[model samples]
Target: MTPPSPATSAPTPTLLWIDASAGIAGDMLLGALVDAGAALDDLQSAVDAVIPGSVRLAAHGVTRAGLRATKVEVEVLVDDPPHRTWTTIRDLLVAADLAEPVRARALAAFARLAEAEGRVHGIPPEDVHFHEVGALDAIADVVGSCAGVEALGVTDAVVSPIALGSGTVTAHHGVLPVPAPAALELSRGWDVLAGGRGELATPTGLALATSLAGACGPLPALRPDRTGIGAGTRDTPGRANVVRVVLGTPTRGTTDAPVVVPADAGPGGTPERAVVLETNVDDLDPRVWPDVLERLLAAGAWDAWLTPIVMKKGRPAHTLHVLCGPEQATALGAVVLAHTSTLGLRVTSVVRDVLDRAWVAVEVDGGTVRVKVGHRAGRVVQATPEFGDVAALAADRGVPVRQVLAQAQAAATAAGVVQGAPWDPVDGGPAPA
Candidate 1:
């Protein structure tokens, strides 16, 4: 079917420009949204949907680097908040009664955090357990930020080039560099810099900004509506350690649709460097292959797979392949050597072009399934429902998995996530503006 032309009457999407030049954190962004006129009640209700009275949101006026701003604190109501895995949190969000946009944004943020943490520590994304990031306060910050943006009627977001910091800081994994591995990993493909001393941009903050905004660069042209400043924990000398959120409408003759663009890409696309490690083994136990692949993934390998091949003696064997980043080549190579029976391996450097991707949630039979959407040049090219979610929903509802898949695809299409559809991640269409 032919697609409809851009509606002349369709209102321009409200643009949310995140100014993180000073740096950002979950609290800082949340506070900025509140200071910019996000309803406190709406933020509270959204947090309560998933965590259920676990945290309280409070905002107050403050000064940072001699600049007055707002600081929102997430107070934990319970003693010793439990650490949650990505799976546990994802399930909680899927079952919660949240606005589609809020839920989708939160889920996407947490998902990015999980992937970054997993790669940093060498574990499967779902199996990676959280420490500080899984706490009640962080959860509140993520949920609150998402809800606050929706409350302000934001339809699209554009984040400034991030301000990563210098020096060293300690985390759940012990003392790490200023930016932290997870933070750096999350900011991959986006513009970033060492903005100051100490750890400025945090994992939670980077995840929220990267996942929600998609577009990264200097502020685009827009007629400003409201500007809010969010204060960080420390009022450092010589700089305002804060994040500023600018809410506005697109200027005339300009489109407000935001698409994920790689910071280092050329006109068509950019090629990224990666290493492929491969080895053929005929004597290893077949049962051990699965464990070997799992270990490789845990060792920061992007992917691991096995192919059937016959050796010189016509013996049936498996050829294992591991793909990883260049920086991870040594560590992943060691993992490959230790797990497999092969004494040697073939290593090749390769370049790959990647499309921009994001996640959105759709409801099927009252259950939520996340759909992974891929975009290029500001238009959606592909949309696919996560089969794991589809199967789980099918099992819970006592329905065939295929039926759930069909429903999810249909829902995604109806929500405007199909190929050639205009880019808008929020379900039920863009927030009323």
Candidate 2:
């Protein structure tokens, strides 16, 4: 059996955009994924169904500015184009039924663009009209990324230091300087390297990427599971000439480790390289727990969970546990007090040894379930299907979810989808797959 199943640790996707040394665009990003051999047809179909108004979605193999790549574009094929506003675009996308978090991310990305356009034209976000980025193709790029992340089973999206490049680029608005105003605004709060000898980062790449990344820092260590490249239209002599996505898990002690990395050791050793803050309280009203938890997470605690225990004289008390990286201790502490009855908190750090991880799509119980694959070197140590997906599939198939799950386990093993993986038992994990 596989050492363990990752059905337990499914990660939110991480995106890494490799500056092509040339530049990138919406279609180029889509094409690079297709060219690099990612399953994108399903994603394209979802985008078509959701986009309101009329838009035709298609992908083709082509070269941009002398770079060989695939270009995904939406054709309006109308006599006149539609002029859209911030609210108009947001409402339309929201109606399309995109995931809630994805919708928020897209809006934030677009907002940054609008803010940049306004600054260049000297207007406000509400008044600014982002004509180019507000278009259908741009929406596809943003939405498609969410879909692509799901399709690829990517858990962690990390990015390298950006290379902004050199020179001026002319656009519909005017001949602006390299990097553009909107691109500059989107890249704020992140480490960026400019003058890569040519115009490197594009407004579309910067805006879409930064918004989704959520947090900006150095490239984290990952054991790549899938590698997909999104190419730009141009080709230069030396650069990779594409935005490459390396899908994998974040583990301990790798060449790609974080500057102030998170340790993977069990709780005791885990605190070594991480922030450990604890507190005890028995007098606080129970009504305030939720706010305290939220404050801690927002402040920087990677996680916070409370445990009930008996203190001196058997007085009922709760022990608060907060674990995070070194960077978050101060903010996390302030948040704990502002929301809880704890007059004080204890803090410390220690070393952690975490298992290396990745993800794979295993066909279990007649449906495709996302199985997280943890690894060390090249060995796949464990794999498991996420119960949520299995539950939904079971509900749809009109059968006992457990039966479907067991079948999927058998199928995955037989099909060699997850070799040497121990199948999770129905009684323990979930009745569903």
Candidate 3:
């Protein structure tokens, strides 16, 4: 009788948790799902759209093993159950016309299960036997969930501790241990809770939740847009046996902008959320530059670089620039002192009108170049050419590095491969690289 933790952090990202102590088979989950209010009809249409031929997913409200729930069953026209292998799943997905990455994720999960089953049974990873029930049920859960995600437009999946109901469950291998082998194998490193009268986390839940979540960890802050609760068959005296699916966006309170300063230390300041630390030095050992950059990176600087320039009176000086989050000011200064000979470093909290960035490979005249495209305020603001790629191609094609860099940029822009910004200052702009 523990009071539910005070409405934890206001939901930020979409998260889901399954409390399966009473017993959560597919049917129970489907029932609770109806109660949780997932758009079952919409999901059905999505499945049909994604998978050819009329597909009907039966989601009817019901109770299981003395618990109220909804039952979901999908009936596909008679055909071979489809060979149940990693590639078998792959080919079915290919023929069904589902999304590529979605198909890949499901296949990877199946491959993991096959691997674990192989290890547990001492068989080849590919040769592990999956019974007809297991294969059909796994496919239904994986593909359906993928379709649901696509319908929900859920980009990320996070999970809470899976409460594993203890006791025996019958599988094709005859009555086996709770969690079964496949489920146990997938549960490694995740928080698992047990203390029920039946199997809580079934293999289907294990494979789906663990594999797609990217990483298993505690629920992150999120904004709940929708809450869908799927039920387990067990009904403890005072608890609801269910899984909760919360969908939402990330709340933005995790970051705080530091006080701003004038760009040139003049009378006023400019708008910018990012900061830069810089200093000029002519009286330092050149041997320390590499170590200095490394320490800056270790200290969490977004970028640290030294630009060689001719100083006043014809002396050669190196300008060190460190770009970082505003909160990084104190730590970066310490790093500067520990690694460099500069006694004073100028700090500026300036707005970095940054653009969303994505990596794209463009076909340059000489060869291929991986260009990073950036966008700001919905317009591409920068396209930074990959330096090493240009250098390598230039050397190979007997062309000047500058020419190679230009060609790469042109190619990236021509193909519309990099959507956002292009690094305008060709020889400028440094990163933590």
Identify the superior model by lDDT, candidate 1 or candidate 3: 1
In model 1, where do residues sit more than 4 Å from their true spots? 1-8, 132-134, 252-433
In angstroms, how far off is 176's CA in candidate 3? 1.6
For all predicted structures, in order, the TM-scores are 0.58, 0.56, 0.52
Candidates' lDDT values, in order?
A: 0.79, 0.59, 0.59
C-alpha lDDT (0 to 100) for residue 347 of candidate 2: 84
RMSD of 1: 12.6
What lDDT is reached at residue 361 by model 2?
A: 56
* Number of the candidate with higher TM-score, 1 or 2: 1
Model 3 residue 365 CA deviation in Å: 27
Please report the TM-score between candidate 1 and the true structure. 0.58
Q: For residues 1-433, what per-residue lDDT tens digits would candidate 2 score against the true structure?
A: 2322333443543444333334455555566556556556755665664564455656666544454556666666445556776656656654665543344445555665666777767876657654643466676776676566545654334455666776787877878787777777767776677746656787766766655453445545655555655666566555556665555555564233344435443222222356678999898898888767865664335689999988999999999999975534543554565456787789876545554544555665446766655444333456556678778888988888897677666655554446444333321121112
- lDDT for 330 (candidate 2): 40
- Work out how many backbone clashes candidate 2 has: 23
Cα error of candidate 2 at position 387, Å: 15
lDDT of candidate 3 over 1-433, digit per residue (tens): 1111111121233444434434344444444444556567755543554444534667755443454555677676536544466445545554555453344445555655666777778887657655554566566666666556545555456566777766888876799887677677767877777756567777666766665553344545667666665655455565566665666674644224364554553322224466788999888899979977876675446788989988899999999999975534544554564356777779886766433455556677736777765544334455678799999999999989999888887776565434443322232222211
